[model samples]
Target: MLREVVTTRYVTPLREGGSLPAIVEADDLGMYVVKFRGAGQGHKALIAELVSGELGRGLGLAVPELVTVQLDEAIAKGEPDQEIQELLLASVGRNLGMDYLPGSLGFDPVAFPVDSEQAGRIVWFDALIGNVDRSWRNPNLLRWHGRLYLIDHGATLIFQHNWPRDAGALEKSARKAVNLEDHVLARFAPDLRAADAQLAPMVTSEAVDAATALIPDEWLVGEPGFDSPDDVRRAFRDWFAARVRAPRSDWLPELAR
Candidate 1:
């Protein structure tokens, strides 16, 4: 029932792999990426967007705003470009939403020139989700106004599906490994990285509250949660902390581990 503000004017495919996202316009607004039917992951991908993006913002990372959309199967079929039209006709009835990235340009962290301290922070977030996009190969990061933005988190939490029995173990592994990235603080050291383990507690109540505050309850559709998104956030924090502090912990160092 959430109507997307953006309308499809044109959809330029980004690449060959994963969801073939398209560039779209939002009623005279700037451009954004509209993800039509991401091939083969599952509904869990939406969960990542909801949880990770919310959690990242809670951690003070800059993330794009999310808008629930309903793509008209006709948009693809209506394409003026015959080639594109045919492609859409073949793949109809896909759900779509816009990813807003204003005045942004993709850049590798090294190219954008962030210091090791900040790099460690980005690495820390990635480690939590076992995010696979930030490697030297894909490095799906962007830069704008001299700041960094993390993007493309479609392939995370997958360890959950593959290793269901060890879900708790995997979460713990992510938390503890965060401490191993001294390279992040090498130049900045304890000052910048002080919040490493300290973040576990905050992620609980405050972060979830922040995210759910922005999200409407109706969308959740009776998903299990604490009293508030903040409460759910606390669940994540407590769970993460307990795992990290577990003896002979499974956590790997946060970055450069």
Candidate 2:
């Protein structure tokens, strides 16, 4: 389980994200950017954040530390904005919190030239997870302390949203062409073949199981067609394992032309 922290105060709302995440102070004396469970995206978004974020970290990517933030309904009483108050009240139990990067800058592909190897790895990783949000228009990446950090994985692993309807969709989706022409790193990703060779073997069943284990049981509960949280975990692990072992470069964006 991720470490749990009690929110001491809600500092301010970050209006940039559609989900309305906020900057909050916690009992641990650390500030976090909290993603509310009350958001329209629901608990599945939080599950994606944990699974994808941990996978990225395991693959040697820089990702923010995550925690389960405990929210109290009383915190909503002090908010003047009715919308924010409603959101807080609805998310009075557990929310997702990411370690706040104070001086980080949004990544701009034009201004920063990334090396081919790193770019290939990033593109490959995003492709493996079926991430559609890392395009140039809304690159969910940050440049902090001279390193790039991945964030906002709530949008990845989209197959989960409809898993109850189509449990077999993951395999089909994994083999489809990735629309990476608009990916922020597309132009810089010169050698995906090399990236696949280097990164694929690292995603073992043990690694996938360990990463999936970090997801909260509450988030896994109520998943359709699953008897328990462990069942859901196994489903995710199996999907990820299949993708890693049988990477379809045919699905990769045609950037080499």
Candidate 3:
């Protein structure tokens, strides 16, 4: 389970993406970028953030520490921004929080070049999770202290959104070809095959289980076709295990040499 912290104050709103996550101070005296369950993308987005973010960290990628933040309704009472206040009021409960990276700069391809191996691994990871948000136009990446950190995984594992329509969607998504032409790292990802060889074997069932274990029960509740949160966790683990064990070299997009 993720460490839980209570929000001490609502500092400011981060209006970067559609979700409008905010900078908040926690009782632990740590600052975090809080992703509210009340956001437009909802709880499923938070689930994706937890699952994919942890999985990336397990793969040796840089990911900020994550925690569950408890928000009190009283925090919204003094907010003058009507929209922000409404968002805060609606999110008065458990929310998702990422340790804030101060002085981090948004990734820029020209300004900061990435090595081929790292690029390939990042692309492969994104493909495995069916992430569609890491494009050049809005690369959800940050550079801090000369290391790249993955962030904003709320748009990943999109097949979960289709559960109400088709429970088999995850299988199809896992097998689908990833279009990487617009991926922020695609231009520098020289060896997708090599990346598969190096990273695929690392995604074991135990690793998958550890990552899925971080998801909160509240976020897993009310999921369609699942009797309990454990059931939902099982489904997620199964999907990820299949994706990792199955050969996905064919699913990788061709990268320019």
Candidate 4:
């Protein structure tokens, strides 16, 4: 279960992504990057962020701490920006928040060198979640305190967007291999085969369940084809569990030459 906090103040809008997540101070007195539930991406994006972020953390990746934030429309009263004020009004209630890392620098491949093993692990993990945003153009990676931290997983688990699909499509999409040509760290990842060997066993049913468990029921409610949020949760858990059990060549992307 995720820790919950109420928004104490609306800090500033983060205009990096289309969803327009913002920096806000919580009642806990911690600063966080809050992803609004009413963003264009909607609740599914927040679901992806929670699941994928927690799953990456489960795999020993450096992802920021995630929390559930309670937002109130009145919190935005002092904001002069009309767009941000409207966004805050729409996002009242439960939203997703990530611990803010101050003074963190955006990752620049030329400026930092990543060793092969760690790079391979990240690539392998991204492939599992079908993350498409981690490219050279927009590497959703942050370098804080000399460590790389993954962020912004709203674009992942795309299959969930169109629920109620046939079993065959689900199977095929789940096993689809990721393309490494435009991946930000493709060149740094030389041995994805070794990464599979090391990380595959770790993506067990327990891990999948743990990650999916973090998803809020509110986010899964009213999902098409599923009678209840638990059903949706079970579907996600089973999908990931089955995907990891498949033959490596079926889903794992090869290291770029």
Q: What would you estimate as the lDDT of candidate 3? A: 0.86
Highest lDDT, which number? 4
TM-scores of the models, in the order given:
0.68, 0.94, 0.94, 0.95
lDDT digits (tens) for residues 1-257 of candidate 1 = 23456465664766654755667676656566655443445434554555567677678787776665444566766778775565455444434354666678877534555665575566656666556566555666777777677676666645334332345664544354333332322332222244455454455545545544543343333445335544543444455445435542344342332
lDDT of each: 0.53, 0.85, 0.86, 0.86
lDDT by residue for model 4 over 1-257, one digit each (tens)?
A: 89999999888888977999999999899999999988888888999999999989988999999999999877866678989888878888999999999999999999998889888889988999988789999999999998999999998988788753667776776787767568889878556877888888888878878888888887888887889988888888778866886777887777656
Report residue 70 deviation for candidate 2 (angstroms): 0.8
After superposition on all C-alphas, the RMSD of every candidate to the true structure, in Å, is 5.7, 1.8, 1.8, 1.4
TM-score winner among the candidates?
4
Model 1 segments beyond 4 Å from truth?
1-3, 80-98, 159-195, 209-249, 254-257
C-alpha lDDT (0 to 100) for residue 173 of candidate 1? 43
Which segments of model 4 are wrong by more than 4 Å?
A: 164-166
* Clash counts for all predictions: 12, 0, 0, 0
Q: What is the lDDT of residue 138 in candidate 1?
A: 62
Better model by TM-score: candidate 2 vs candidate 4: 4
Residue-level lDDT of model 2, residues 84-120, one tens digit each, is: 9999998999999999999999999888889988888
